[model samples]
Target: MTRIVFLDRDTLPTRPFCFDFPHDYAEYGLTAPDELAARIAGADIVICNKVVFDRAAFAAAPRLKLIALTATGYDNIDLPAAREAGVTVCNVRAYGNESVAEHALMMMLALMRNLPAYMRDVAAGVWQNAPFFCHFGAPVRELHGKTLTLFGRGNIGQTLAGYARAFGMTVLWGERKGAASVREGYTPFGQALAQADVVSLHCPLNAQTRHMIGEAELQMMKAGAVLINVGRGGLADEQAVLAALKYGQLGGAGFDVLGQEPPRNGNPLLARLPNLIVTPHNAWASAEALSRMTDMVEANVRAFVAGTPQNTV
Candidate 1:
């Protein structure tokens, strides 16, 4: 029988797996760095999300044949080490498209309408003692007649474009930064920033994309334009964003991720600002998305065992 071990099962917060093949399955709610090697020892398949597996771990797991990922990103795993160890790696994809797109849209609408500021005022009884029938403190902007520029043209970005179009907003796909020539359907990077009333980032973080948005990019944006990031946190410089928000260089900013998750140390973007909104990286954790991700993970594992690996990364 094949031995399967899930290192960080609590990350999914979903239903238990139902494998079709005969297997010895084991799971841990959360696995620490020191506990990983022993937990995965002698296992034919290892499933994980956000667990870092280095060359040492791969070397220790002599029986490991497959590394099934619950999330779309496999950055946490060392792909080179896995390849050398003869381990087949697979990751779920497009499962969180709708969930993440909706989250980004929600943040855009809330920031543009100054929803958070008004809710705070209402909670403080400011609305009850209003000078007039209504209280209008912060500037409220509409999505209609505005330009929405997207950095990535993936499934999530396309879905967001459709939603923006429904609200009468013009959508533009931005070409990669520092490219020699612009793509057919994409606007140049700097030009897109200057013309955008709102900019959303959906591109993956890599060598050329990490810290892609810094002081220079912020200065290029239209004054009082909103910035939305549901992608990786390392895509933007947190200090630069904080300064932009403080100096009124940006109308507002929304982020679902930070450079370092759990942010146990500290982050400049964590400052209390009326124009800033930060979510705890739950943009891809909607019930529907989680269900799809778990199902895909199961399918990947089953297919690998049947000698036809699917969703290989």
Candidate 2:
């Protein structure tokens, strides 16, 4: 019998699919941080979503053989500790690329079209006494004919680029490290950034990408261009973006994530910048994506019970 414990079940809002593992198994609905060690003590497979698997917790899971991360990123798992403990780590990949890419487009379109702001204005009765057809407190921009530049070439980024092309916008992307291979007729990232009419980010947060777009990078962008981030929030300095927004260096900004989760008080990112559009990090939670993720989880457990492995990270 294999005891499987999934920590932090609240990370996903929708109902999870029923477990259909081939071997004997137990799946806890949700386990908190404090209850982690106790619940996982005799578990052979430990599933986690944003739950810390530090040295202490890993040490306590004496019977743990396989650790399956619910998300693509395995940063929550301590790799060295898992290696010494002989715990195999695996993660689902590319399962939510289209789901996340669509979210990026949503934010971009909402910001450009003054959707949220106009709705607020109308709700406040300001549009009732309009002098003419409309009051121009919020300006709307068109998406077609604008150049869209991306910073990452991973699954989500590539999918977003495809969406940009579908909208009749030219799409370009930057290399992860060195100069990227030049696709025929495609603009290089460096060249594209300097000239992009709109720039959207889709890269992971790492040593090479932390604050990748700071003062210098912002300066390279053409003034009055929009910038969006659906990727990890640490790629751009929040303070720098605020300053740029204040001084008119950046025309508009949209984000589905922030550097800090649940965003701390006085984080300096909450200052009401009218041109900025921010949403809680729910970009990957579409119903279709969650269904696929559940399938991946089942596959992971079945593989482990069969003395095999799948989706190794």
Candidate 3:
């Protein structure tokens, strides 16, 4: 009999997580760092999303065989620690490609057309007194004929490139920063940044990529170009973006994630900038994506239990 424990069940909004095989399972709405050991003491498997499992937690759970992630990103878990403890880790991939690509497009379209400011004007009754057929408060740009630079070449980024191409926009895949040589299909990273009318990021955050787009990078962008980040929040310098928005250096910006989620402490980008749009990191939470994620999770667990494992990360 396998004992599986889900440390943070509230991470996913919709659930009744099912397993095809017979096993004993338990779930906790939320679990803090201090509660990890006690909650997983007797468990043979742990399932989590956005929950941190350190070396100590792994050492405490001698019977733990697997750590199943409900999301793609595994930055929250300690990989080396899991490996040292002989715990197999698995994550679902490509499940949210369509959902995330669509979200990046929505953000780009909204910012490019100045939809936020226009909507605000309409909501404030600025259009009620009708001076003419229509009213415009800011410059509206079209997607056609603009150069779009994508920072990641993964599934989500490739999907967005297809979408951009279908809209008559030219797309450039950017090579890694400071790479010794450029790849066949990728543009030199900095050169692509300079040529882009719209820049979208889908890269993972790590040592080399944290704050990859700071003040200097912002200065390199075209004066009126827009930036869209549907990836990690730490990829850009939030304060620099705010300053750019204030001084008109950046035409507009859209972000689906922040440097810190729930940003309760406060963030400069959280201000009501008409040219900026921020979503609560739900770009990958579409109904279809969630269903696929759930199905993959079940499959991964079943395969691991049957002497084979898939999607190891």
Candidate 4:
């Protein structure tokens, strides 16, 4: 029987796994760095979401044949090490497009309309004690007639574009930064930033894309433009973003990720700001998306066992 071990089952909600083949399955709610090697030893397959599987861990799992990822990102796993160890790695994809797009849209709408500021006023009785019939403090903006620039044209970006279009906003696909030339359907990076009323990022995090947005890029954007990031935390410089928000360089900003998970050390962007919104990286955790991701993980495992691996990364 094939042995399958899920090292960090607590990262995701409880979901049923129905593997067709005979297997010895084991799972733990959470696994720390020191406990990883021993738990995965002698396992033929390993399933995980955020657990790191470095070269040393791969060496310890001598019988590991597959690394099935429940999330779309495979950054936690060392692909080169897995390849050397003959471990086929697969990741689920396109399972959270709607969920993530909706989250991004929600952030954009809330920021544009100054929802947070109004909520605070309501809670503080500022609205109840208003001298006038209505209280209008923060400047509210509408999505219609604004230009939205998207850094990625993948599933989530495309989904967001459709939603933006429905609100009568013009959409622009931004070409990669420092490219020799712009793609057919993409605007040059700098030009996109200058023209955007709102900017959304959906690109993956890698060496080439890390810290892609910083002081220089922020300066290139319109003074009152909104920035939305549902992608990886490392994609933008959080310190620079906080500075931009503080000085009114940016009208507002929204983020669903940070450079560090849990941010145990604290992050500058966490400070209370009327124009800033930060979620605990739950953009892809909607019930529908979680179910779809679970189903995709099962498919990847079954495909790998049948000698026809799919969604390999």
Please rank every candidate by TM-score, starting with the best: 1, 3, 4, 2
lDDT of 1 by residue, 1-313 (tens): 9999999999999999999999999999999999998998899999999899999999889999999999889988999999999999999999999999999999999999989888889998999999899998999999999999999999999999999999999999999999999999999999999999999999999999998899999999988999999998899999999999999999999999999999999999899888899999999999999999999999999999999999998
What local distance difference test score does each model get? 0.94, 0.81, 0.92, 0.94
Root-mean-square deviation (CA) per prediction:
1.0, 2.4, 1.1, 1.2
Better-scoring candidate (lDDT), 2 or 3: 3
Model 3 off-target regions past 4 Å? none
Candidate 4 overall lDDT versus native: 0.94
Residues 1-313, candidate 4: write the lDDT tens digits.
9999988788879577889999999999999999998999989999999899999999999999999998888888999999999999999999999999999999999999999989999999999999999998889999999999999899999999999999999999999988999889999999999999999999999888898899999999999899999988989999999999999999999999999989999998899999999999999999999999888999999999999999999
| Displacement of the residue 67 alpha carbon in candidate 1, Å | 0.6
Regions more than 4 Å wrong, model 2: 21-33, 176-190
* Residues 138-159 of candidate 3: C-alpha lDDT, one tens digit per residue: 9999999999999999999999
Clashing pairs counted in every model: 0, 0, 0, 0
Better of 1 and 3 by lDDT: 1
Model 2: which ten-residue window has the lowest total lDDT? 17-26
Q: Give lDDT: candidate 4, residue 94.
A: 97
TM-scores of the models, in the given order? 0.98, 0.91, 0.97, 0.97
Give the lowest summed-lDDT range of ten residues in model 4.
7-16
